[model samples]
Target: MTNSENSSGSILQWLGFRGARGGRSVDGKPAFANGAGNVFQQARRHLLDEIAAFLLTYELDVTPNNLLTAHGAFSGSNPALARKIAQHVTAGLAVTQEWLDEITAADETIDKHDGIQHLMARLETTLESFSKNANDTRSATADYTDELEQHVAELDQVQGTGQILSSLADLAKAMLERTRKLETDMRRSEEEAKALRRSLEKARREAEIDHMTGLPNRRAFEAVLEREYRDARASFDPLTVAFCDIDHFKRINDTHGHDAGDRVIRLIAEMLATISDDNCHVARHGGEEFVMLFRGISLSEAHKKLDGLREQMAERRLRNRKTDEPLGQITFSAGIADVFDFSDPRAALKAADEALYTAKQGGRNQVIIAPKGGAQAA
Candidate 1:
């Protein structure tokens, strides 16, 4: 009885359907009045049904995050999300809650700066202990030799059996000399051990770092991960872990050569370093890949920080130094996971890797967050 009815009548009359409230089709099925409002309702109903079917197809929950995600994918408003879902489908991957949560949020993870420093400090302490023990052993042997000589001299002064005293002196002198030689040998051995220890220490420190980028290497990152996990738990502070890989790195190497690729790798490392701080840590995970850790920050905040770095890198167009060839915009894909969300650091790391895989498949250069069931930081 209002404009709504009038609009319905207009739309219905245009379609040659009689009346606005109740109508029937050629097949004898009850139909809409064919009004614009009725048409919208029909499409809305269908869209909701499709969303429900999608949730059922993947056994996804109807939580707000999931619901909005499903709507975005099916409603065609978010083409990127739709494109990512299509990629997952094409790859035959299960449309999972974790994957959906990750892609929808879009983020990264954490690494603490002090983790490797802790390892190096502990190693230095151990080396120092060994050095101290070797010196102590040498000093004690020298003093014992001196005391033995004094005892033998006192025995010589006593009016004892001449041959017995002489024999005792001779044996004492031999024992003293041998002890002295042992002390000398101990000193030499200690010196050589110290030298070897220094070399070993140097090698170990180097091993923990990427020579090209001077960032901690993959081995170092694992140590950092363990320590950061423990510290974050103890402090009840938030921690995040992330895996990053340069997008299309292989193409760069193939097209521009390894030298240029190496330059690109260093550039990426330097950019990552710009964000490194007491709370944020970065490392060179391996060839064209890196790892990050964040402490005392929420997942969303950490994601913003890392995403900033990602965007900054993408905005820059680089050129090959040697050949002066334009390399276009260089970018990387990243995956972030909340450390406390998982039972352990390894589990979080695995989740981050899975997220990283999705980011790559979702058309690289974006940060993705791997969301497991939520948990308190502790």
Candidate 2:
């Protein structure tokens, strides 16, 4: 077969379709069945059930993006992501929207979606223009007030002026007072707009960051990946991406309670951060997972470094200071892939994630390197 034909066949699996097109997706029926009056309610119901399960399971907010996210996880492409979520379900770990956002962050779509960021940006632009116009109008009104005051003075200077002059003076005073009020209102409106613009900026920054770890969240990482991918490919520099998961973290939470679990999570964050530098970027990718991006690094070299960290972590035993209860050895498993080897960064990320699963299945506390340029890393 031609390369195109091979790619077409492989895309079916990559896109979570089984057997052939217009057929099973993820499970039994096709995902996203054809619309335009097609008899596909059974498939529709199945997909709805999957969406509902995700919302109800995690108590996630009912939003269109959340619905789409869940659908993609359970019914659409990336069944591996669905499987990973199932593991969390089995472990009884708390699920957060942040976690879902992180793991599914590999969707290689551009930021063309109509979202709050675009909305806020438009609002800011409008407000800035409005504020400038308001200030300009205020300044013009102030100059007009000065002109009005001079006219009133000229009327007073007229010798032996009658009642007409008195009426003109009264009218001029009224106009002056009204102009002052207009200036004050315009100034107030400008200040309010400036304040709102500042708030929007702050909100935008917060949305891209993880509140728990104060690190770049999945949404932020997605932007980073896109930029780094371009820079890496252009410069012909090797870029490595890895996914890491804390081994038996839910057990830690279950045995020692959430407080201890929080500490363990923080400790892992710190340990991972030690490896971060200008060439390496690390972030908490939601829940018990962290993602790292490395530029100018080889795959096996990155693995050697991360694997060494894993061994050190495995050798250390922790304890809960609250009750002084002993906690078993804490360690993390990692899966890594070189970005240039894959057709795209998203494929590389999925491959790395599959390797992470191998590390887990092969017994945790180790790092696995995926085969070059393949979808199934392990």
Candidate 3:
């Protein structure tokens, strides 16, 4: 067969359709569907247009990060979830832009303040020089007056008096100019310093936030966990740690796509965030895993909380939009361990991980509690 014929066959195989050769349509024209002239080209153009529209509609920039994020959003089983992820990405971009603005403001404010300091330093130096000059002028005037007294001569004393008066007037004019400049420089510096302080505050707040889900990231979680653990240790209160994993998460990715997997992750993250409060901390621990720190809660209370979350997840039914097919039950398994039960807080985390592993093995949808001292799951 010719190259064009071979190409036509490949397109037919890809689309899972076979077209008859040398076929005629009802209109007595060459049937494009039958592997005939420019049909493949037309289809290719249409597909490209559709892809371009998808990219434009989602505002998905053709960069690696954006492309990955968009892929995750669109490949998901549900359109609603895709839209949520898109909105979330947009909000994240906005926050990032806000941070850039604050940092920029900080840069400008620091530069402005630095300029003011330079001006003030210059003014101070000028004032000091003017003061020395004034002192010298006074000393000269005193000497001139004394000379006039000592020499009792008419022309010499009169000339010395004229010179002393002229020096004093010049000194006063220079001092006045320096004082005004110093005042202006000081006021401008104070204003810029205030602006710098505000930017610093914004930076601190944004630092703790996770760029993906707007929840506290792992770093923030660790900070809170350490402080809470210490406080709980001192007060002899219970502190529980739960390690959560999305069950068969890899299967979701394999079946639907990574974007679909991402949707599931975001959904669970949002649910965790919504259920958490000031006393409790929830954080993504990379991939389809999460960690929750429950301060001042007993083992049973922590277990109950996580199990409740698992049940909520069990109730959710995610579906594929294109195929109108169910993606099956989405669930998470959790392992909870109380920090007070162990000598080391790190041991508690190990216990939680162990429990999580057990939960995963024990049929993949339950909360398992690990005993103290990294013992077997309770």
Tens-digit per-residue lDDT, 1-378, candidate 1 = 223223322322322232212234455433433443766787675456556656766678889878887677667665556666666654567778888878876721111335567778999999999899989988879868876788668677767598776877777888899999999999999999999999999999998989999999989888887888888899899999988999999999998999999999999999999989978899998899999999999999988988899999999999988889999889999989998888988888888888888889888899999989532121
**Which run of 10 residues does model 2 get worst, by summed lDDT?**
1-10
Question: lDDT for every model?
Answer: 0.79, 0.77, 0.70
Query: What does candidate 3's lDDT look like per residue over 12-124, in tens digits?
Result: 23222211122335654334445535867655543433334344544445665444433333334224334433343334433143443354355457668989999999999
Q: How many clashes (backbone N, Cα, C below 3 Å) per candidate?
A: 10, 0, 2
lDDT per residue, candidate 2, 230-254, as tens digits?
9988998889999999999999999
lDDT of the structure predicted as candidate 3: 0.70
lDDT at residue 337 of model 2 (Cα atoms): 91
Question: Which one is best on lDDT?
Answer: 1
Q: Can you list the residue pairs that collide in candidate 1? A: 108-336, 109-241, 110-240, 110-241, 110-292, 110-293, 110-294, 111-292, 111-293, 111-294
- Can you give the lDDT of residue 250 in candidate 3? 92
Q: Estimate each model's TM-score.
A: 0.52, 0.54, 0.52
Q: State in Å the error of residue 234, model 2.
A: 1.6
Candidate 3: regions farther than 4 A off: 1-182, 320-325
